[model samples]
Target: MDAILTPAGLLQRSAPATDAPRRRPTREEAEAAVRTLIAWAGDDPTREGLLDTPKRVVKAYGELFRGYDEDPHAVLDRVFEEVSGYDDLVLVRDIPFQSHCEHHMVPFVGKAHVAYYPAEGVVGLSKLARVVDIYARRLQTQETMTAQIVAAIDEALKPRGIAVMIEAEHMCMSMRGVQKAGVSTLTTQFTGVFRDDPTEQVRFMTLVRSK
Candidate 1:
């Protein structure tokens, strides 16, 4: 029998085998690979069970962790000057967030408690959330993520102090990988005044726990 090649097969034959291996996957490549993973995992990728999953997951990721492409200073560029000279404590609590643990690449579900005391001026409420997202998107450990969030706030605002607390359940522990199942971790970072003054630190802790 003579050989016959389909267009895709010909392309595959002519294409350099190592081309893709030499380069990192782009966002689209990652998404497509994820769909491929579904197929490899003993299921039909085209089934209604997964009809929109690939697109939805890709879009959700771009929205959830869009902070990687954002500059922290840019997020903090616009500050609020209408605080009536109220410099005391600025708290934005229960800033809900979700992240992927670097160790297992599984989800970590949690809320962040962020606060800072203005050094020169204060930032918008949403910037705190942006800071949280910035550090959360990357493969991360809870401890590092907590510290990064605090550091970003400290650097951008140069606040008298900054504090971050992350209370989360890591799927690396909860899901199949290790399977602790019901354990949660609390991680925190404090800077400047939040670290210097015991009274101030205690107050911030109290407020975060109150509700």
Candidate 2:
């Protein structure tokens, strides 16, 4: 996929592709790095209480960043064209996700609301959730994550239009600098007809805001 900066100044992927290849550290190497961090924080990594902490952290990292192991396009490859002429809007809202911030390695928890206007086909509703999870499992920024979700569906499904909005609380902000607890960050992306038509955009917001 190609990454582009949207008008909102968010990084967005244009198409889904296999994850890039990179040299990965071995488990021992990862544990050693965690040990270094522990010592840097003035903790004795070798102490009886902390001796296994590095190992545990390394294992946890594997689960936390498993998005690298997945191909989002694969999840969206299956399309069902027999919609029986039902083509309005397919929206999946309030998809809960957890991701670590790439800059701080701290977590941000959020919900994503995804909507697409089908041109001729539709995929399973669950597939949209899976796409969100595939991206959420990686280290991210909320703006970029929102754009990526919309891009994946737009490219794979060729939808008439797509919209994505994400609302999140970043631990890096709440637990550290400025420490404004309960504050939320919001980001959105729109494409195709959703970008050209103001009424459709308003309708999308209405549907999203409706209880």
Candidate 3:
């Protein structure tokens, strides 16, 4: 992909995100909607015990869904070129995250394992985790979130190779229909060398699984 320049004046692989078309609901409207949900759930929203539940849920939603207002590219805009030429695979494993399932709006908690081989430069280790958190804050499927992590890093850093693995337990499956817990869903995404070369992919997984 051709590099695109970002507002940060840095060249990256993807374009900046555009704002959503529709206007966001006001706080009052959001809280009111929560009240409606509470009532639909066979609860009294006006009761003393449940009176402020809507407000609390709305406030929590703001934090949980703040990723829509965040920019993943910005987190990775700054690149560090001075690695003393030590350009091997940089991997960050066990990155814990909690993302809401788009299908049911329930949470899927998981840890992300990320690896990338630098082409231009490396980013701060924390930035990779931050990228995961940003995307995880939004409504997502485990599969889509895994690919998005790879794309965000691949675009911002234009790495020679990139790999992402996510293992999660979705509440939609456990706490609802299936009712069976402890089941995990694993998803992976590979690009460049990691995609073209099978051994590299093996090595990436090996490192992640290793102690």
Candidate 4:
């Protein structure tokens, strides 16, 4: 008969292998993949309008999904502790972000509101926006994007708490698919004290909503 195992033993046995991390596509590989996708969409990739499209798209994607190449941790590596004893909520709002929805490959344009209570340090206001762009420029779901914004800042600043809210209109919903016209989507993610505390969360919401 097989011996019974403790939860820790079971977990250890079930751990994922670390031998191989997935490889990213080379530039040529990426371009080829895009060309194939263009063909599959029933468009003449060789047409005058599209003759150079693959190259252009590959370049565009290099910029769009460049987040895949960057480490979010590194993006927030440095921190500033010269708060001058100012410990109130630090709010950065109305940061414009443009992203593509992974499901439909359509655009979503909107603003991100990011805030955090510093534990020991803080990051530049613009870095927060850059962090938002790093995540937004990729194909992502609004939910994940919202969480990533909060998580990146949380990691960078070691904040007491972090709140991120995104409100955007998706072209996938407006232009095609369900075609909801002007309907917009809202997604929010809270971490640390923001998740366990009510007043802090409400204040963050009120501030962002005022925008």
Query: What's the CA RMSD for each of the models?
Result: 12.5, 4.0, 5.4, 6.4
Instruction: Name the lDDT value of residue 36 in candidate 3.
Output: 94
Give lDDT tens digits, candidate 2, residues 82-114: 989989988898899999898898999989999
Model 3, 1-211: lDDT tens digits are 3455444233344534666465789999999999999999999999999999988998999899999889999999999988899779999999999999988999999899999999888999999999999999998878777767877887789899998899999999999998989999998888889999999999998999999
lDDT of 4 by residue, 1-211 (tens): 1223332111112334565765777878877887798899998877899878878888988887787777667778878889898767888999998999988888999999999888898888878888888888877888778766766676567778888889999999899988898897988877778889998899998988774
Q: Scored by Cα lDDT, where does model 2 land?
A: 0.88
**Local lDDT at 26 for model 4:** 87
Summed over model 3, clashes come to 0
> lDDT score of model 4?
0.80
Residue-by-residue lDDT tens digits, candidate 1, 1-211: 1233432111112345454554655877867977998999988878997977888888887776665677766787776767778888889988888888766678898889998888778887887888787777766777767766765666566788887788988888777767897687998777778888889889988999996
Each model's TM-score?
Answer: 0.76, 0.90, 0.90, 0.82
**Residue 4 displacement (Å), model 4:** 27
Lowest lDDT sum, 10 consecutive residues, model 2, at: 7-16
Clashing pairs in 3: none
Tell me the deviation in Å of residue 125 in model 3: 0.3
Candidate 4 wrongly placed segments (more than 4 Å): 1-21
Q: What is the lDDT of residue 211 in candidate 3?
A: 98
